[model samples]
Target: MAFFGFKDFDRLSEVDLNIYRFFTANVDKVPYLRVRDIAREAHVSNSSVMRFIHKLGYDSFPEFKVSFRAEQQQAHPTNHQINFVTDQNFPTDIYEKIELVADRMQQADQVIFCAMGSSGALAEYAARQAAAVGFNAICVKDPFYPLVNQLKNTSDNLLIALSVSGKTIELLELLNNFINNEDVTLVAITAEPSSQVALMSRYVLGYSVPQQRIAKYYDLTTQVPALYLTEQLISTARRLAVQAGDHLI
Candidate 1:
């Protein structure tokens, strides 16, 4: 919601940026936290909190918190927790979802795994796993010269994109080109189904894990959910391929 429809972040002072980072990092607790609570945790003054609130056009923290929580609730109506060991909210129909993705992979002329940074390594692993299962899979390591864009003859393609936040600018830009492509069946594995990339996907595997950051910009979210999802997808697709061949025989 563009930071809950607040756009004055760029106007914040250098010191204010600290408060901004803390606020974003702890957004799940924002509406419940008192202004003094925020001030203490963010290591800022009460007046600085007031200034930050005012800069975002809220007359007071209560007013801002209400709006923030409302926007968050409206965007995400369901819990996204995917911790297999502890997340009771883990998707109940996950196997069904994996089957659908497997169908897409089995039908594809080629499969592409798209991601960057930490997720990029996972993408490479997924690509190799898919290849081992006999699918023509490749990972796009560099967005500038992606093999997905260069392929000409393949009409049916399956794209598996992974991102913890699903807000990566480069990945979003790359997806912009495939939003309307009838030939591409996109499966977005990300932290939130409401994220920009997930919105563009034909199928989505969303998981809720804690987002951790280093230096306020580097993402350290756990990739276990993504890894598990890809492994399940490849396994299902391989089995489906064999069954379909048997039926043909």
Candidate 2:
């Protein structure tokens, strides 16, 4: 409730606004982040982050976070409502898609996790978890330069693209690069099954969350579904590998 108020943030500079947006979008993770971490994620200077905190009438980042967490803790218990993607009754096809994605992940030689913005952070985390279970995985935040350079010659790779809308331009362009490549498989964890990314993906694990929009741009769509999908894929793949006598550890 405290973080959602925009009166003060609306009066700030553009850089501060971007920082506010990032903080708001990722408010759930703020309790674990430092001032420098927020600055880096918001693409701003540490001084700017301090100034932004001061603008909210906090003398220091720790004090500000204490209040932020207090406010969240106060509201979170009541806010633990049903999640459409995780708690609601989904159709049979939803589970089927997850199984198919798990099958593809188990068979792939390597895994590439792709996303943009906050989702890229998630992709990196999923990649790390997959690698821990012995799957060769890497996170590609940008599909342009570094990713293209690293994965140019690789084939038999599984791409797990996470986008709530499934319409990110850069991600789609990257997916299209291997649209006809039989050696690469695309698995989409998205909110919209009809989105370009989902349509092009070989398997789609979609969620049923109400798309949140501000000024005709999607802003607040939760990614719990993507996280769920990644965890499921990792667990399913791990179990299958063990059953097949493939030493995952």
Candidate 3:
């Protein structure tokens, strides 16, 4: 069910990309868009829309929508767990925390790893590990529109967002959008379960760590736990892939 190195869409022409943009922008409006409607939105002819769909590996518009939904489901599975970290002190039991994080990663289809400041570094590391193991993983940051568009094209992509305070505005907005979309799966890694990010996420992975503020630099104290969690997730995903004979690149 993996879509690794699939280049069918990479060769798309400018016209085709434009058509994709139009459909993406109006995904909510047209759950199952008609050929005429797509043409109207993209300012193209019916024939062109049909041709574009064909190029995108779809026999017909209806068939395409069905496949799209299936893909989404495959990319995002529902089995998951949430951990709430409320301790103001460092994690004393490393093995237990790692096991918990790994357990959560084992259940997700794909990890949409995200974080702010130092936490962002951890998110990137986790995403790379998932991608390396042949999982459909992505790292999302401040400019989230592109990531959102990419998610729309795939199925079953799980979001793993990390924030210490669980109150990052950018991360909150992104989580809010996904919360409204029943098709997406969200996992928030934060220090507080009562924070905004946790409230919006379907699953919350909380860790206890000290919070620190800086006038001109990113907070590092709150980021250590996030990094540890990210590593655990990456390790767990790799182990699962190995057991399933789906070793990633």
Candidate 4:
């Protein structure tokens, strides 16, 4: 409820933040509501609403609403719009790939998540979910966080790699270290399934989210697609764990 008002969330003042809270709370109605309606609901002047839109770089309320609706399309696309792809060499469909990763987790003694930059958050989230479902979870956010021990873990491991571009040099190098290990099963969730990350993975779940960046370093692409896919995988794995009589924490 607190982080969805504008892309420049950090630059907002306390009053603007309050307006943002109102927007997040009533997201479905904001785009359709008139400026006066928003002002009344949010307990602010109409000028405040105008200022909020202007601060976000929109010329007018209509322009802002149009962009907001388009953003909504990307964030909450319909189920029929959900699509995942993988390399042609391994064509087992998306649902089957979920089952495949779940099967690997069933046998894996360790579940390590490897990612960096903006993607590091997804890695941590997926790792916590993995541990919640009972696998010993390890998160490697730093690219150089002692790879020798993580390359293979107790003869059985599953590494879930996340990236938007799938071309991160340090991350790819880390994955390459585990690519040849027979006991390690690598799974990649990326925008580009054909990239080297997917090529090295034992299974790949690809989504077609548009890549976005800021000034130079920040990747602004929506992680909604990847987030949904990872949650699905963890949920499926949790189901498998329950069916097998494992006590989940």
3 versus 4: better lDDT goes to: 4
Evaluated at residue 158, the lDDT of candidate 4 is: 85
Off by over 4 Å in 1: 1-89, 246-249
Instruction: List model 2 lDDT by residue over 1-249, tens digit each.
Output: 255554855569998888888887887998789988999999999999998888877888888898888887776756465644544534457766777777778878999999986688889999999999999998989767465556678778898899988888889888887788787888888888899999998888877777787776536767677787789889998887888788898
| Candidate 4 residue spans exceeding 4 A from truth | 1-92, 150-153
RMSD of each: 15.9, 13.4, 21.7, 13.3
Please tell me which predicted candidate would have the highest TM-score against the true structure: 2
Candidate 1 residue-wise lDDT, 154-174, digit = tens = 689888899888998899888
Displacement of residue 63 (Cα, Å) in model 1 is 58
Model 4: per-residue Cα lDDT at residue 216: 72
Reference-based TM-score of each model: 0.63, 0.64, 0.55, 0.63
lDDT of 1 at 243: 84
Q: Give the per-residue lDDT digits (tens) of candidate 4, residues 120-151.
A: 99999989888876878878999888866745
Q: What TM-score does prediction 1 earn? A: 0.63
What lDDT score belongs to each candidate, Candidate 1 first?
0.82, 0.81, 0.70, 0.82
Any idea what lDDT model 3 has?
0.70
Cα error, candidate 3, residue 218 (Å)? 4.3
TM-score of 4: 0.63
Give the per-residue lDDT digits (tens) of candidate 3, residues 1-249. Answer: 112223567767888878877766664455577789888878888988888778876667787777666655565556754543434433456456545555556665666887776677778787887787677777876646566676676666678888888888877777776776655777778888789988887666677766777784557564666676676667766776677676465
